[model samples]
Target: MDGTPAAEIVSEVAPRAGETIVTHQRVTGFHASSLDVLLRGAGIDTVIIAGVATNLSVEGTARAASDLGYRTIVVSDGCSAGSEAAHSASLESLGLLAEIATADELLTAVHTPATV
Candidate 1:
């Protein structure tokens, strides 16, 4: 399988029309990739991460974002792994480092008026 080409992203999870795709071979999205630069170039100070393998890439990316001085938010329910236990456990660990929020809660917060 050494020569086997890496599997490409499937259509279902593919980037949409206007969304750019950033591919990386590392477990972490920020490792040896332009993701951070691309995001910063777009003036994105806050990152909402969601993808497969919650305990691996997603968690790594979220931690990297946090270390990079970004307001990182990992969409708890938006991520998945091989098992529910792993997913929950990873999120638990991730919550200690970054904010863990549901899609609904994030949407509500975005729409809610600021008290200030």
Candidate 2:
């Protein structure tokens, strides 16, 4: 699995030098990974998640992150499911636990300066 194409991060989103990468083996990224530890170590309280399987891995991770007390956000357009209904349903359910935003909204929020 380590050497397989499926396990590789695509070039577009590949990690740059000095960036930390954590690998997970369960449906939720935090289940058996260093993600929680790494985030806590970095003093991160917010988590933005984007990936495939809107009804499975994405939802699972979002729920786990929310339950862990992190402010979670799911990029709606950045995730996909086997069908539109499934994706919509997942997002609807996740809305109760996490914030849902489109890629554009996320980018704008990231770029907008915070005012004190």
Candidate 3:
């Protein structure tokens, strides 16, 4: 989630179990303190991103993840946008700059490990 409202919604629908949910105040980047702390603490090397506003929060986080030297994967099908053009453009951009895959592909990669 990008902000408190979205985070609240996610919490209402499915409370975060052991995973940490970091809320960024703006879309400038993914330099959130909570996120950095969580990722480092959890020893997370790869970030599989999926969420609404594909061109906004999702892209921001993916790009930041890349900058942070983490293996970033954008789940194309698991994300959406207000318009098809925006969504498609976001996917294309991420594919060109980072790893792009569907949710199933990510699952398989995680499960098999060698397939990645």
Task: Show pairs that collide, candidate 1.
Answer: none
lDDT of 3 by residue, 1-116 (tens): 54457346554546457755455777623665478667778898888888878999899888888888889888999889999999999899988768989989877867984733
Measured by lDDT, the strongest candidate is 2
lDDT for position 44 in model 3: 86
> Can you write out model 2's per-residue Cα lDDT over 57-108, one digit (the tens) per residue?
9999999999999999999999999999999999999999999999999999
Task: Give lDDT per model, in order.
Answer: 0.90, 0.96, 0.80
Off by over 4 Å in 2: none
Counted clashes in each candidate structure: 0, 0, 0
Cα lDDT over the full model 1: 0.90
Ranking by TM-score: 2, 1, 3
Model 2 lDDT vs. the true structure? 0.96
How many angstroms is residue 62 displaced in model 3 relative to the true structure, after the best TM-score fit? 0.6
The prediction achieving the highest TM-score against the true structure is: 2
Flag regions of model 3 displaced more than 4 Å: 1-7, 11-13, 113-116
Off by over 4 Å in 1: 1-16
Error of 1 at 64 (Å): 0.9
